[model samples]
Target: MNIKLIAIGKTDNKDLENLTNIYQSRLGFYINFSIEIIPDIKNVKKLSEEQQKQKEGLLILSKLSATDAVILLDENGKQFDSVGFSSYLQKYMNSGIKQLVFVIGGPYGFSPEMYTKANGKLSLSKMTFSHQMIRLFFIEQLYRGFTILRNEPYHHR
Candidate 1:
């Protein structure tokens, strides 16, 4: 199955962008993986938190197709270890989904509509992380999960 990561805004840090790219490239070897970055909202200073989330959510939803199995990367969602995550990936593949989309929302989080549209939610960790840093972490984890599935040495038990 194809896996897509959708996140809002660009990574300003060059190092983080480079590292995220490395993992993204590695993922291509195992599956059809891609990241779609929704440009940051302009003039956020005037918008309320809820307003910003609504605006960002609209952009996020626009990237999705009706057939896409959308999963939100939410802090309050289910958490899984590396092995478990690999199995989770396996389940989706086994289910024959065309594209499994994971989204990382904007600062104030996803809007009500986004939550309603999502098939599920996953938490990388309970601890908060900057959205930019989360991009790198999530991509690396995706790579690790695939390696684990292949019984590669990339992930050591």
Candidate 2:
């Protein structure tokens, strides 16, 4: 199955961007992987939190196709260990999904409409992380999960 990560805004830190690129490149060996960045909403200071989420949600939804199985990276969602996450990826592949999309929403989080459209929600951790940092973390985990699935030494038990 093809996997994609959709996130809001750009990563301003060069180091983080480089690391993210490294993992993203590694993922290409195992699956059709790509990252799509939805530009940050304009004039956010004047918009209410709900308004900002609503606007960002629209952009997120626009990136999706009707057949995409969307998963939101939400704090309150289910958390899994490295091996478990590999199995989760296998399950989706076994199910024959064409595209599996995971989204990292804007600061205020996903709008209600976005939640309604999601097939599942996944949490990287209980602790909060900056959106920019989360991009690196999530992509690395995706690489790790693929390695684990291949029984590679990249992930040590």
* lDDT digits (tens) for residues 1-157 of candidate 2: 8999999999999999999999999999999999999999999999999999999999999999999999999998999998999999999999988999999999989999999999999999999999999999999999999999999999985
Q: What TM-score goes with each of the models?
A: 0.98, 0.98
Candidate 1 Cα misplacement greater than 4 A, ranges: none
lDDT of each: 0.95, 0.95
Q: Model 1 Cα displacement at 119 (Å)?
A: 0.7
Give model 1's TM-score versus the native structure.
0.98
In model 2, which residue pairs have backbone atoms overlapping below 3 Å? none
- Error of model 2, residue 108, in angstroms: 0.7
Query: Candidate 1 — what's its lDDT?
Result: 0.95
Q: lDDT tens digits, residues 75-99, model 1?
A: 9888999999999999999998899
Clashing pairs in 1: none
Error of 2 at 18 (Å): 0.3
Model 2 Cα shift for residue 35 (angstroms): 0.5
